[model samples]
Target: MKKTLILLSALTLMVSCMSKEEKMKEAEADGNEAIAVKSKLIEGAGKALQEQGKAAAKSASKGVGDVIKGINSGMSESISQSDVIPEASFKANFEECKAEKIYASNDDKVKKVTIYLIAKNDFKGDLILKAFNADKKEIGRSRLKADIKKDDAQYVDFTFDERTHLLQTEYFTIK
Candidate 1:
């Protein structure tokens, strides 16, 4: 009876020390279950975020569309063809001069036009003023010798009464 008890104990110990193949299979089953649970959680989170993103995008698109529509309506009402009269007055730093439209009288009987220039620095150049009619045709032109000191403002006048309604002015360095 004692021998039978020892044999039973040895058998239990052997069973407890399982084979490598059986241990590997058990570990694989546990790993696969963990991976499946993690995958399910990740998929659920991703779907929830995707739905939120879609809703946000739809709301943002509607807001942008409303703003664009408002701008278009405002522009169409404010800017008409008849309101596009020739511009008047231009002031800027005169370094490296360029031609610029000054004023539009829209009156063919305008006898005199004046251009005002303020010299931030001492300047000596030829200032040219040109007048045009409603048809964009040049009607009169005048050139003036400019010799101005800093902080000086001068007016260059042109006698123009030949159906000229628009004025453009430019300046060039005199060599």
Candidate 2:
């Protein structure tokens, strides 16, 4: 029973490191890949228990899953680190950006566009902001803070200089 608990606990830890998309794929894949991943985790845990002399008290059972809610919250707060943009961040250029009144004043000067996202509290996934042109040209984008409220998950700030072009935007929610 101890061995069984240890094996399952270790598998949980390893699987925790995988992204949700990968997990979905694993679930959809044939049993082979699943078994391999499971086997690897079990073997690793057994080794740790032996070498660490039981000092390996970090139970896989109490890993990221136990505090998943908090861990994701922490991840959201740590989103601006350049390498961790939630997959839900992007910009799409579309039509409204050329709607006469808005575009008439838009020249060609583009200073910069920062795209990001802020996850709504309790919201399953991150919010998405996209910018599109009249021809659906992806112009620019930026996500809000990772830890933003749903009511505040919206960011459509389009900035330009004398060198930017008329850019339209389309916003969507992604979970």
lDDT per residue as tens, model 2, 15-62? 778888887878878577878899999999888879884544456545
| Cα lDDT computed for each candidate against the true fold | 0.57, 0.44
**How many residue pairs clash in each candidate at the backbone level?**
0, 26
| TM values, all candidates | 0.30, 0.22
Model 1 misses residue 154 by how many Å? 2.2
Which structure among the candidates has the greatest TM-score? 1
lDDT of 1: 0.57
- Candidate 2: which stretches are off by over 4 Å? 1-120, 123-128, 149-164, 167-175
Residue 38 CA error for candidate 1 (Å)? 91
Estimate, for each residue in 43-140, the C-alpha lDDT of model 1 and write its tens digit: 99899979897898899999999999999977643331111122222233332222323333456454454445666677777655554445555556
Q: List residue ranges in candidate 1 displaced over 4 A.
A: 1-110, 161-175
CA error at residue 170 for candidate 2, angstroms: 7.3
User: Would you list the clashing residue pairs of candidate 1?
Assistant: none
